[model samples]
Target: MHDHDREALAMFIDYQRAQNLAATTIANRRSILTTFARTTGTLVDCDPFTLRRYIGRDARITAGTRRTERGALTAFYTFLHDEGLRADNPALKLPVIRVPKGKPRPFTAEQIDTLLASGAYTRTRAMILLGYYQGFRVSSIAAVHGHDIDLVSQRIRTVVKGRKEVWFPLHPMIAELAATMPNDGYWFPARGGRAGHILPSSVTNLITRAKKRAEIAERKLTPHSLRHAFATDLLEEGVDIRVVQELLAHEHLSTTQIYTQVSEQRKDAGIRTLAARDIPTSSGRGAASIAA
Candidate 1:
C-alpha cells in the first residue's frame, strides 16, 4: 500500500508546521514531495545525484528554488533515517548555489500618477490602491472576496499567503469606494465566488494594458512594483523603517531596510533645496554708506 508512503509525507508536513515554516514554503515542499512520492511509489533512500537530475529538468526554476528542493529532500531522508528506513543521509554531500543580490526597482511618482489615471472604475482603482496604498500582493488583492472588506473601519482583513492575517487601512477615497463595493461579489469583481477567483496572470494583463494606455514605459513596470513604490512613498513621507516593516508585515528588519535606500533620495532632495535657496546679498558699501 502507498498508505505508508502517504503517512510519511503527512508526518513531514506536520514537522514543517511545528518548525514555523511559512505557508508558502510548506505548500511548495508539499508539491515537490507529492510529485516525488507519486513518481517513485515509495519514500525510500534518495541521493544528491538523483535530486539534482530531478531539479535539472525544470529550466525556469532558479538556484534558490533548487536549494529549497534540496533542503526538503534532506529533511525527508533525515525523517526516514530516524524511522530506521535508512541509515545514511546521502543528500548531505550535495552543493547548493548561492543566492544573488539585487535591488528592487521602484516606480516614479509620475508613473504612479499615470497608472492611477489610466483606469476607469473599480478594477483599476482597487488594483492601484492595493499596490500603492496597501502594499498587497496581486494574489491577495485578487483573493479579496466581498466579505474581507470592512468599509466602516476603513480596513481590509487580508489572509496573506505564508503569513498571518493583516488588516490594511484604505486611503480615504479608496475607503469611500470600498464602502460601495458589492456585498455579494469581489471587490474587483469580474467574477463570482471564493472559488471563482482571479489569477495573478489576469492582474498582470490588466496592468500591462493600462500602462500602454497611459504611455508609461513597460520596462521594470510590473504589478510588484506597486508594492515597491508603496514602500518608497512611505519612506519619503518620513515614516520610520520599523513602522513600514509592520505595515508591510515583513518578518525581517533587513527586508524593511531596502526602503532606507529610498529614504536617502529624500535627503538628496533636501540638499538640493538648500543649494537652491538664494543667500541674502551683502552690500560691500554698507559701512561707508552708514558713515556718510
Candidate 2:
C-alpha cells in the first residue's frame, strides 16, 4: 500500500474504534481493507464494477463471506468519502449480496432433554446451559465471572457479542453451575490466555466433547446450536419472536426471524392434509386403488 493508503487505513481503523465497534469487527474491517490494498491496488481507485468483479473473482468464498466483504468495503468507502478523502463512495454502489436462507440448526426436543438431564455439572455442561438456558454466546459463556452471578437478584451480567453489556436472568440451572465456581475472576479461566479466560473456541471444543459424552452422533452440531435451540424451543412453545429477540439481545428483528423458519415437524403436519386426501387417477380410481 502507498503511504496515502496506509494513512487512510489507519484513520478508518481509528474511526471504527471510536464507534465502539467490537474488536473482531474492527480487525475484520482492517483486514479486508488492507487485503484489498495489497491485492487490488489503491482502495479508492476501484469503482463499483471493479470492486464487484474483485469480490466475485473467488468462487470458493461462500455467499455469507461475500456479503461481509461487501459490507466492509462499503463501510470503508463511506468513511473515506465522509472524511473528504474520496470524491465518491464506489463501494456504496455495489449491488446487494444475496445469501441463501438456511434453517436454524436447533437441537431436537429429545436431544435437549437428553442434554439437560445428563448428570453432573462440568464446565462444558455449564457452557451449554448458558447458551441453551441463558441464551448466551460462546464468548459470553467464557467471559462469565463469579461476580457476574448475583444470587440475590437471580441475574448474571456479561458482555455479549458486539461488546454489549447486559444482564440475563440467572436461570436456576446456571446458578447451580455458578455456585461451584470460584467467586472471583473468570469462571472459566485460562492462565495463558491474554483475557485471563478460556478462548471461545476452547469453550466450543468443550461443548463438542460433552456432546460425545452425552452419546450424541458426531455431526455438524455446533456450540451455537444451543443458542438456536434456546430461540427455537421457546418459539415452538408459542413464545413471541419479539420476546425471543430481546432474550437473544439481537440488534435486528430480521436476524431473530431467521430462527422462525418452519421446522420439519411443522412442515410435515401442514402437509398431512395432502397425504390424507385422495385424488382420482386417470382410471378414475381413488388413492386406495393407486396404492394397489
Candidate 3:
C-alpha cells in the first residue's frame, strides 16, 4: 500500500478511538479501510466510482452488510476531507441500500407459559421472565447486578445504548426473584471465572436449552423474541406506541411502531368483534324475511 494511504488510515482509526466509538465499530472501520487500500492501492486515488465498484463487487453480502460498509467508508472519507487530506468526500455520493423490514417473531402467550414451565433452572427462568416482562436486550439483562434492583421502590436500573442508565418499575415476578438475590455482585453471575455478569451468549444458550426442553426448539425463539413479545403484547393491550417505545428503551418511535402490525391473533379477535355485533330488529315484512 502507498505510505500516504497507510498513514491516513492509521490517523482515521486514531480519530475514531478519540471519539470513544465502540471497539467493534473501530474494528469494522479498520477492516473496511484496509480492504479499500488493498483494492484501490491508495486513498488519494479513490473517488465515488472506485468505492461504488468495490461495494458492487461483493454481491454475496446482504443489504445490511452493504449498508455498514457504506457507512464506514462515508465516515472515513469525511474524516479525510476534514483533515484536508482529500479535496472531497467521495463516499458522500454512495446510494443507500434499502432492506425490507421483517415483522418481529415474538413468542405467543401460551408458548411463553410453556417455556416458563419447561423445568429450567431458577436463574434461567428469572432471566427469561425479565426479558419478557421488561423488554430488555440480552446484553442489558446480562449486565444486571443485584444492587441495580431497588426492592423498596420496585425499580430496576439498566444501561441501554450510549451508556445511559434507565430505571423502570420491576414486574412483580422479577421483583420477587430479586428479593432473594444477594445484595452485591451480579444477579446472574458469570460462569468459568469470567468477570461481571453473564455474557449475552450465555443468556442465549440458556434460552436455547429451555426451548429444547419445552419441545419448542422448532419455533426458533431467542431471548430477543421475548423482548419483542413484551412490546407486541403491550401494543395489543391498547398501550400507546410511544409508551411501548419507552418501555422497550427504543431510541426511535419508528422502531417501536413495527409492533403495531396486527398479529394473527389480533386479526382474529377483530373479526370476532365484528361477528358479535347485534343487528337491529326490523318491523317490515321484508326485514322479517331477511332475518329468517
For candidate 2, the 10 contiguous residues with the lowest summed lDDT are 275-284
- Candidate 1 on 153-224: residue-level lDDT in tens? 877778665667888776676566666666677665555544566766677778767778788776867888
RMSD of each: 7.0, 5.6, 4.9
List of clashing residue pairs for candidate 2: none
Which prediction has the highest TM-score against the true structure? Answer: 2
Tens digits of lDDT, candidate 2, 228-264: 8899888888899998888899898999998878577
Q: Residue 210 in model 2: shift from native, Å?
A: 5.4
TM of each candidate vs. truth = 0.68, 0.78, 0.76
Q: What C-alpha lDDT do the candidate models reach, one value each?
A: 0.74, 0.82, 0.84
In candidate 3 the C-alpha lDDT for residue 213 amounts to 89
**lDDT score, candidate 3:** 0.84
lDDT of 3 by residue, 112-221 (tens): 89988999988888888888988888887777888899889989999877667899888898888887776698888877887777777788889888888898854646
TM match of model 1 to true structure: 0.68
Off by over 4 Å in 2: 1-3, 41-44, 109-121, 193-195, 205-220, 268-292
Cα displacement (angstroms), candidate 1, residue 141, comes to 0.7
Better of 2 and 3 by lDDT: 3
